[model samples]
Target: MKKFKVLSCAIATTLCLTMAPTAFAGTATKALSVNTDPSDWDRPNAGNFVASYSAGDNYIYTALEGIYWSPAQIDNYEKAYGRYLTLDLKEDGTTHSLNGYSATTTLPDPKFDFEDDQEDESSTTPGYGRNEEVEVVSRGALSDWTRYNYTANFRILNSSANPYLITYASQSIPPLYPGGDYNNVPGVNTTGPALQGEYFNNFKTSNVSSSNSTKAAKTVGILSNKVEVDTHSKSKKAKVSKAYDDITNRKQLEDYKKKHRDLLDKKTSKKDNRNQKVKEEFTVTFNTPVTAKKIKETISKHNLKASVIYARGINNLGERVTIATTELTDESLNKIINSKDYSFKGFIEIEGEGSVADLNNVQNDAEVYAVETADTESTEHDIRPMGLSWKLEELNK
Candidate 1:
């Protein structure tokens, strides 16, 4: 397949002639006047045509200036033929007709008169109120926002294109003119002769006229607005990135759980083997402050190895201290719980190979007790197990 370079305004002009539709000279013989400059139209900057693709609705919106004699002329046109903008779009080497206008059968709000402030501001300008025009907005479905040539029969291209070329020509359409007759009306002879045979051939290639042709062929160009198109792609990328993050986080958590299954199983086992005893770990937290001296004394009395994993101030609980120790016998636990020196205001939680009886006794003796399982999983997994799942469901919803 041939790779045609994306046709832009500059590139399209080089490949084909792009005449400003309004710039075309009107025939002097015609009674009605024509103004092609979009700004000359009734609405502010009406001549400045704009093409934009909306991904949300999968449509292309085009705004342009339409000619009108008076406010009544616009109303009459709508009443007789109904307001519509004819569109011819060239996509993938073929032209498609997609015309659009206000969905309401009746004309909505018609901006007829200019604001008094605007007229006063531009009073010094030539032919101020005499220039009659109105702005027309139309939309058509677009499969993609990328490359496509567009042409509106009654409207000038906002910018320029090569695949679809638009040459400006206007004719006086009497009020209550029938629909689809705008293009068929004869163009009045302007002050200067037409450029067809005088300066360019029918194809606009060179200044040569063939006996069979009477005018220059219409030039074609694509319609595109780069900003909106880029935004569409960025939005798609962001959605994909969010989905990828959710899937990756969920997979990482599942993998981590699979690899650490043995550790969790051994911790939960009830067997009292020697290997289990050395591997056993439990955290004991106290509600009241316990001095290092008191902690050392308790560990010595019970013949248990102890390590202070967290200090009171460093942890969330101001006065609570956490100490890790090996598995303890039921007798030792009972002694520690009933000790007169120590208040035993906190509970003891076992990590591995501790009996349910021991857990019940510890819970019964202290205010609160909870098993602190070892988390070999990633920090993301440790925070919220259902975080990604919730996000996925939200996206689907």
Candidate 2:
């Protein structure tokens, strides 16, 4: 297991002076783009590792320009160690870690033809590369004009070693040695043996650092920048429950019909008509035994069009239970339940129509222990499925 030292350095003054602290406040902005091109920034030496950053209302975005390796190198590196980029974000003196990878299966090959012309080795550039972008949101609201610091690093496994190893930070090699502040030091072989068919046998040590040793691995660092987050504070609100009466009470079916007029008229009119003919069975149970005749009489008293289908034998608790079928609208059923004089318990299992409010009203008026819906196929009688289906059908139609 080999280890390297961590490096730290402030970004060049030229890059920092380009953007003012006040200019980034109260505004969403992106940092300068980073790439292999040397002429893009004042520090042309930082081309190996380029980065761009932006701050939005709630999140900070960071993009790392990918390093190019020959297909052979990628194949061998991926075989020895998995491909991944580690990001270290420093905000208000705290460090956060993030990871990203290539979004695509196959990466483009190196752009320059290194094999055809050995004489132009100095002018040759990476032929293949990748770019990774990640968005990070703070746990709490970010303060406006707050300075944020960040560093990015790329790594691979050193399969050439007997134990197999990976490096985090490069050893002292000058200028690019320390990498940057918050840099990771390469340590012992965390990952075990390499798999068969992996391209590790022909591994290239030059790909690991820029050191003078034959075992040196390639390491690059971007010009670190201080990003100022704009002032945008979110205020906490006191939660108050709105009274049910304060809400505009509209019939569930009417609301559905109004929202899907085009769909009902064009596509589902026939299906909707068929659904209207399907009646559903509802069971009303009492804590004490009540006669079927009494239940039927009660229905008639409330002006509800419901018929007692059957009455069941007394349960262990000696409570009377009756099942009834109804084609009455949900509003009508709610009205009947609200008008009941005696306390009862039960569920309204409607085949096609009903709302949560309707079921709630029934439970409140009848002291129901549970409510079930056949249309929803759920014991809790959720109306979301019906609403979702209606909306999707309307959209598709």
Candidate 3:
């Protein structure tokens, strides 16, 4: 094995390339969660792209600018592709529209239940964290407005696992902004010590972008509206399109989940592994006899989402009935695998039999498909557990 240096923060030229269209859906209503950390993002920022957030307008944008685009950091983003969108809810968890964001890290937990749910918001503090619930949000839904109880204070998220949260920006001189203008913020730290329960009134929202759109608007041609981030803070974003066409096209987010939910579960340490059991979401597709509605209802009884599109010509279809949980243990964990839903004669079992070679193989054909995935490019990131990510550098030349 070889160790690659963690990607340093710097803008690079992003070129449009053609690839094969995936035979799945786009990121719409689901999320792919994994137990990972900063060290993970720190691994390498390759195969990932940087995106910019456009609030109020309900869009997440990425610039066409890169190091290859302009010598200065300000004139980066040029192309505009509103790939993903957000949905608005009417209290019933029903999606009402489309939305987007700046970085993949900006995505909120999909199955958000309560306003006060405890997931760490990577950018700002008091984030929507993942718990034992399936956050059923649609693509481009409002990940904004997380419910907060703590008053008068902004929760500055470190995104680091081991944290020094109690101290204010004062305890440490103002850290370099992620992508904010570096010159004006000052060298000697100005933020101060404060009461434990008291909120920092002027808690700053530092937005960074190596995107030409942001940098250009602020520094050169366009309406520059960007916060200066330290030179140390670099980000990238990439646009992926399946170069080839097929009866089915590939997508990320929603589309990927439908087909790959099984892989999601397979990634789990199942059966006699003895490692701590964390709940994960998996999707299953039923053939011939099962109805998507009936399968969904059955899986829903277990808190899962089922869909028909992924199944296409198949019968009942579903992926995960439950998200992987960190709170589960031994025998209690086996219940899911042993449930009637996953019985040897059932659809999921059949799919398992198709994929796994030795014990799980019960069929020659596999159900479900995965496509349209995205990764956040970073050299070093202070990420929370299960942070959404993928690598575009892996695709970039």
Candidate 4:
């Protein structure tokens, strides 16, 4: 099989921050707008394989920028103060409140795993949630995403604006690469053919070489496993034990057994009622080493509500990214199916498409894809007909 690679840049310095409010004639309505001049930065490719019939001047591409603050990090920071630091924007038309991060503020606390730290290390750190940065880009604004280009890097704060959630979306600008990032090379890794579709399914280690770049490096695949959900329902086990009549009271034990058996039967009945349903698990793996920024990008694209998880050798075969879907919406599922991420990453079924590849803005989604009990995986090395690498382009127009 043919192979190629797209590199996701973690650090870029050439892009400039552009935040302007859109203007409307004779009206006072709340909206956002912008104009920009990006600094020196190279563009990264999001695959554009589809053919556009329009010629020059037929379309104009506009770029939008989206920045993300960790929900866990920021919310926790605010929770410690008995108030949240970031605006909790509600799609239900509720106003949200967001407190900007302060660089010098002390962290409230950090979640601790006693088993991992053995209680010796102080889990809290200074500025744990104060890590705020911007992701900027200029590209063709196409909802169907026929034209676009992008540049990214870990950013320095603009310092002039308070962070805000996207309230408005920009419209069309001309596309950057009309033809998209078509696969330029042909030969793949030695293991390409041998480790086809089922590679991640079996948790096997494999290698594939890039058919495009100037350098040839071995690629590793990362995968997410099927989740094991153990439901805990209302139980009297703790209540009975708390009675405190005696440590070995037979009545307590008897009460527990009766309740436990009833629960078992209840669980069995529920499973039996929904006999045809399957639990879906979609896994996203990186073939290349993913940076903290790209991991956030992957989660946002899928809408799985993911957080970046890192631990050396945890997944057995680590490719730098491991985005596991703990929860998914039906709409997100359909999007996953049609998504470039779904196709490029390879999956038994799509959990969600990797839209940063082809999607301009999720202006309006007609279909979304998700899988149940089926697994999908991504790797840094996987090549597509239009070779591209992406993470944040999904947020902008």
- Best-fitting candidate, measured by TM-score? 3
User: Candidate 3 lDDT, tens digit per residue, 177-219?
Assistant: 3211111124432322111110111111223322112211111
Please give, for residues 204-323, the per-residue lDDT of candidate 2 as tens digits: 211221212222132223222111112232322111111211123334433433333332233223445554333322223232333434544434443332321211222233322222
lDDT per model vs. reference: 0.24, 0.22, 0.20, 0.20
TM-score (all chains, Cα) for each model: 0.17, 0.16, 0.22, 0.16
Model 2 lDDT at residue 346:
34
Worst 10 residues of 2 by lDDT: 109-118
lDDT of 1 by residue, 1-397 (tens): 0011110111111101123243222111111123333322211111222232311221222222222333322222223221222222111111221212111001111111110111223345422211111111221111211122211211122212222212222212211221112122234323211111111111222222122222223322212111111211212112111212334354553454343333345544647654334432333333343444444444444333332111211122221222221213343234334433224433322122233333223323343222222333433322111112212222334
lDDT of 3: 0.20
Clash totals, every prediction = 19, 18, 94, 37
Off by over 4 Å in 4: 1-333, 338-397
* Candidate 4 lDDT over residue span 261-323, tens digit each: 342233334545453232212223233333433444445654442311211111112211111
Q: Which stretches of candidate 1 lie over 4 Å from their true place?
A: 1-269, 291-294, 313-368, 371-397
Candidate with the greatest lDDT versus the true structure: 1
Let me know the TM-score candidate 3 reaches against the reference structure. 0.22
